[model samples]
Target: MRTIRIPYAELPANARAAVEAHTGPALKADSASEGLNSEIAVRLVSRTGEYYVKGRRASHRWAWTQRREAEVNPFIRGIAPALIARVESAGWDLLIFEAVDGHHADYRPGSPDLPKVVDVIRRLGQLPCPTIELRHAEQRLERYVDRPEDVAYFAGDTLLHTDWNNTNVLVAGDRALVVDWGWATKGAPWLDAAFWVIWLIASGHEPASAEQWAAQVPAWQGATVEGIDAFAVANAHMWDEIGGHDPDSWTARMVDAARRWRDHRKA
Candidate 1:
């Protein structure tokens, strides 16, 4: 479910003060059209310039997500919007970012943007996994693996975004900037390419065509068929639980796409 957005004025006085202390008084505050996990998704116009502000009460589950984004932003520099500042006050946690002058990435077949997306994925896979503690993909995929031993297949030290929905990527100039690092994981190098397959399928590619695109990435080429199969099965099951069999929901459709990919590989 989407978090309910709140107006900048509606935030507690201390929270607003914390922000103004950094950006000078806000000249304008407009609700942002993007972002689903933040309660405060607004673009604030300060004397300095434009900034995207995101926040939620510290007690909310997504509050942890805010912290993760803040922790990982600096490390993901070239692929993410610059982290301008971070603040906490009035029991709310927040992240302020340099707003990107780009739109969500286009993943449709034949779009010129597709090559940039692949390049970003390839570049991200090359960075050694940061030393900070990250949720291991094996642990995250545990419940869905058909065989208990298959969980080990996801283990690796590569840094992975894990979620590849087009909304999390922005196409800017000649590059695709990856945004929203909350679900970042340290896992198999092939994991990011695997996640992108479902997104390509959702964007109108057949399962085989999506895999063909994924194969262009070196990491995907290195992945064992058995390991990739397990990842697909786990992801399909995970979304099934999230969407609860709702056929019309995007999550449910992704669940089907993941299954189709798994079946295609089996064939």
Candidate 2:
């Protein structure tokens, strides 16, 4: 569910002051419209510099995502926006990031951004999971798996950016950078590529075509056929629950996409 957005100007004076300490006097605070999380999402411009700031009430159920993003920033430097500061003040948790000038990636068939995104996935596969707090892939998906023991196929040490929607990826120059580390997971090296397959399917790729794209990632070759099939079945259940069986929603579309992949794997 989307949080009720709070305007930057309406933030408590103390909280604004805390943010200004790093940004200097805020000349402008442009609220972002794209993200689902973060009640407070904005681009701030000051005489000193520009930044992307996002936050939630410190007591909000999902506030832990703020801390998670901050903790993982250092480990994912070049592939993501740099974290400038983490501010906790007046009952809010805020994270400031270096402003990135880019557009959300295009995932349509034959889009050039596809290769850039695939390249980033390749680099991410080579990155070692850091020793910070991160959810295990199996633990996160256990409730949705076809069988209780199927979760073991997802266990591994690779740092996985489990969310693959276009909004979470930004393209600039010759590169595509991923954002929103809130769902970062420690999982099998090939799982991230597997995750990308559903999004590709949602964006209009056939199951076979989407698998072809996922195959571009070196780690995709390491995926066991059984593991991939298990993931497809588990993800379909997960999306079904998340989308609440609503046929009009993106989650519903993802459910359709996941089921297609699951059936394709079986075939």
Candidate 3:
């Protein structure tokens, strides 16, 4: 794959100044891919200490994403990385956070951490959030749906991560911390739960084991087979909008898995 380079010089003057101010002269900086957002990582060296910097070029609505996270970070401390500072200037938003230590979890099917991953997500769903309204399949469908009733049956009320994939989670010291809160919103918690379920199964877990893991989460406990089916459909539609590699294949697999689960339940 060709390396994509960002036009860092195009950043507004204030944003550039902020970057320089945080990382004094003789600092090493590198850009990292953050999927939906324009992101860069800077490594600073100073007499005081060394720290990592993350800067994201913001859209008009970019500040809200970080600000909202700032509000929630304290409450969910330990479950996510600590938020250090956020800078908003001239159509750009920069956020400095404590660098999470550890590599991304290898999320193939039947990975040892799959159950733990499900548990962490369920815990996130249960966290107290007074301000943000969680979104469900219906809301996501409305925003990204191409056809009516495309996501009709999957709607529910729960705080959802919206995007739950292997790349977004960091595993450190036997704990799984979810990162990239940019897509988080209030909605059916199961939407996020189901999203991960499909991921786990596709990564290579047997259907029975994946279903067992899914059932352990309160958000998915007692969830009918049909409910999971609807979630699969809605999730596939949402994934299409994100346009990842081999989306068609992944979507087909999710659909097939959902159908198989439904058929097994009927039998």
What does candidate 1's lDDT look like per residue over 1-267, in tens digits? 778888888999999889878877999989877767678888899888888888889999767778888888878888789988889999999888987788788889898888998999999998877777688999999999889999888998899998888988999899999988888998889889999999999888999899888988899987898898888888878877777745657666787787787778778
List per-prediction Cα lDDT, in the order shown.
0.86, 0.92, 0.61
Off by over 4 Å in 1: none
Task: Estimate, for each residue in 77-187, the C-alpha lDDT of model 3 and write its tens digit.
Answer: 766888766767766677766666676766676477766677688788788754553334576566544456645555555556765667678788778888767656665
Model 3: weakest 10-residue lDDT segment is 1-10
lDDT of 2 at 253: 82
Model 3 spans with C-alpha error above 4 angstroms: 1-13, 19-26, 33-36, 41-52, 60-64, 133-137, 142-157, 240-267
TM-score computed on alpha carbons, candidate 1: 0.95
Minimum summed lDDT over a 10-residue window in model 2 is located at: 242-251
Candidate 3 residue 211 C-alpha distance from true site, Å: 2.5
Per-residue alpha-carbon lDDT of model 2 for 93-212, expressed as tens digits? 999999999999999899999999999999988887899999999999999987988999999999999999899999999999999998899999999999999999999999999999
Error of 3 at 88 (Å): 1.4
Candidate 3's TM-score: 0.74
In order of TM-score, best first, we have 2, 1, 3
Give the per-residue Cα lDDT of candidate 1 at 101: 82
Whole-structure CA lDDT of model 1: 0.86
Best by TM-score: 2
